[model samples]
Target: MLDLRDVTLVGESIGGVLALTVASALPDRVKAVVASNPYDYDRRYADGVRRGNVFANIAIGSYAIPIFGAINAALENRLFLGWVLRGGFYDKRNLPRDLLAEFDRVGRRRGFRYVERKTFAGWRSWNKARALYKNVKAPVTFVYGDHDWSKPA
Candidate 1:
C-alpha cells in the first residue's frame, strides 16, 4: 500500500473521473482534486461521436465494435493520434510535435491497444463515477477546455 497522504489529485478526460473516484474513496489522503473534462456523464461516448468530425466519428465509433475494434486500435498510426489530440485543443499549436510523437510512441507499445479498447468499452461503468462526488470531502475544482469536444458549450 502507498503510505501517501495530503495529496492533490489532478486529471484530464477519463483520468479526471479516476481522480474523483479516488478522492471519494480516500477522503483523508486526498486533500484536493482538479478534474478536467471528467467522463462522468451519461452517453459521453455517443455524444462525442455525434459531435466529432468524420475522422473522429469513424475512429471512435469503430472502438465500439468487437474484433474489428481491437484491430483498428492496434493499427492506429501517429497521424490518426495527432488528429485526435489536436481536436481537443482550442489552439492546435498548443500540442507540440514532440509531445504528439511521444504520445504516439507510448500508444504503440504492446498491450496498450488492448487496454485502450477495454477503456473505451468500459465507459458506461465509468460514467457512474459521478455518484461518488457526494462522498468527496476534499475541495474539488473542475476545468474544461474551450475546445473540449466531449462537452457541448
Candidate 2:
C-alpha cells in the first residue's frame, strides 16, 4: 500500500463530489475537506426543473445532436467566449484580464473540451451517490458565492 500523510482534500464543482466520496469511504485517511460550489444531486428544485422545464430538457438533449460539436466550437470562439465567460460572472465589468487569459489558455488545451462535456454528462448520473454524503466522517467545509446562478437552485 502507498504511504500517505497530511491528507487535506480540497475540491471544486464536480470534483467536490469525488472528494466527498473518498472522504466517506476512507475517513481515517482524510484529515479535512474543503469543497466549493458542490452540487446537491437530491435537490427538489433541480428535480422539479428537470421534470417540468422544456428548456432544461432541450439543453441536455442537445448533446446528442450531430452538429453539437460544431456549435460548441463556434461558441468557444474568441469573441463568443468573452461573452460566455462574462455571463458566468455577476460582475462582468471588472473581470480580471489574467483570469480571462487563463480561461482562453485552458480552453485551447487538447481534449479539454471533450473532457468538460463528458464531466457534465456524468453529473446527471450522480443522484444515486447522494446517499454517500451522509457517511462522510471528516470535518467538511463548503463554500459558495452569493452571485452564482446555481445558488437559487
Candidate 3:
C-alpha cells in the first residue's frame, strides 16, 4: 500500500475519473486534482468514440461482446493501437514513438486486455461515477487537448 498524504492527483482519460473518485473518497488526503480528457461527460461509452470516429465507436461497442471482444483485443497490434491513439492527439507528433511503445508493452500484459474488455462491458457503471464529482472537495483543474475525445463544455 502507498503511504499517501496531502497529495495532488493527476490522470488522463478514464484515469481522470478514477482520480476524482479517489479524491472524493479521501477528501482530507487529496489536496488538488489535474484531470485531462476525462471520460465523465459522455452519457454512454460509445458516445465518447462517436465524437472521434464512427468505426471506433462501433469497435468500442463490440468490445463489450464476449468472444468477439476477445478476438478483437487479441488482434490489436502496435500499428492498430497507434492508429487508434493518434486520433486523440491534435498534433500526431505529440505522440512520440517511445510513448506508443510503452503503451503497447503495457497492453500486451496478461490480464490487461481482460480488464479493458470488462471496463467497456461495464461502462454504464463507470459513467455513473460522475455523480461522485460533486463530493470532491479538492480543487480540480481540467485539461483538454484540441483533438481530445471529450469536448470542453
Candidate 4:
C-alpha cells in the first residue's frame, strides 16, 4: 500500500501518548509526530502530581472557584511562577503572563460549584490513562524537560 502522506500529529501531556498509539495502530497513516511534556504510559514512569501540587488539585477540585479568590488562590502570579519554574516546559518563555490573569478572570465566572465538580471529575478520571499508556504501539518522539516529572507530591 502507498504510505499515507503528510499525516501530522501533535500532543501534550497524556494526549502525547494517544498520538503515539494512533501512529502505531496505523503506521502508514502517520508521517510525523510532535509531543510536549508527554506522559509516560508505564506505571513506573515518574514525575506524577507531586505532594505540593496537591493544593492545586484540592483547590480546583474541592474549593472550586468561589469567586475572585480562586484566582489569587490557584493561579496567582506567584503560583504561576512556581509552576513555570517547576513545570519543566522547554519553552516556558513562550507562555504569556497575561494569559494567567485572563484564565483567572474567566475561571472566576464559572463559580465554585462548577469548578469543584469539574475538578472532582478530572482527578477521578485520570486513572483511565494508566490503561492507555500500557498499549501505545506507535513510533513516538517525546519532548520534555527534566522538571516535567516532579517528585511525587
Candidate numbers sorted by lDDT from highest down: 1, 3, 2, 4
The TM-scores of all predictions, comma-separated, are: 0.87, 0.74, 0.83, 0.48
Runs with alpha carbons beyond 4 Å of true place in candidate 4 = 1-4, 40-54, 61-96, 105-138, 150-153
Per-residue lDDT of model 4, residues 5-105, tens digit only: 55877888666756765665666677777777655432321224322244443443333334554444454444553463334334656557676666556
Structure candidate 2, residue pairs in collision: none
Which predicted model would earn the best TM-score? Answer: 1
lDDT of each: 0.80, 0.64, 0.78, 0.50
The local distance difference test score of model 2 is: 0.64
lDDT of 2 by residue, 67-151 (tens): 7843654356555456555554668676687878887888788887666556555655556566887888888998888875445
TM-score of 2: 0.74
Candidate 1 Cα deviation (angstroms), residue 137: 0.3
**TM-score sort, best first:** 1, 3, 2, 4
Q: Which structure is stronger by lDDT: 3 or 4?
A: 3
Q: Pick the candidate with the highest lDDT.
A: 1
Decoy 4 TM-score against native: 0.48
Candidate 1 lDDT (Cα, whole model)? 0.80
Residue pairs in clash, model 1: none
Residue 62 Cα positional deviation in candidate 4, in Å, after optimal superposition: 2.2
lDDT of 1 by residue, 1-153 (tens): 789999999998788999999999999999999998887764754445335466776786787788888788888888988787666666877889999889898998889987877777787887688888999999999997666776753
C-alpha positional error of residue 73 in candidate 3 after TM-score superposition, expressed in Å: 0.8
lDDT of 3 by residue, 33-125 (tens): 998877776676546654555556666667767799788887887887777776666776788899899999999999998888776666676
Q: Give, for candidate 2, the lowest lDDT window spanning 10 residues.
A: 44-53
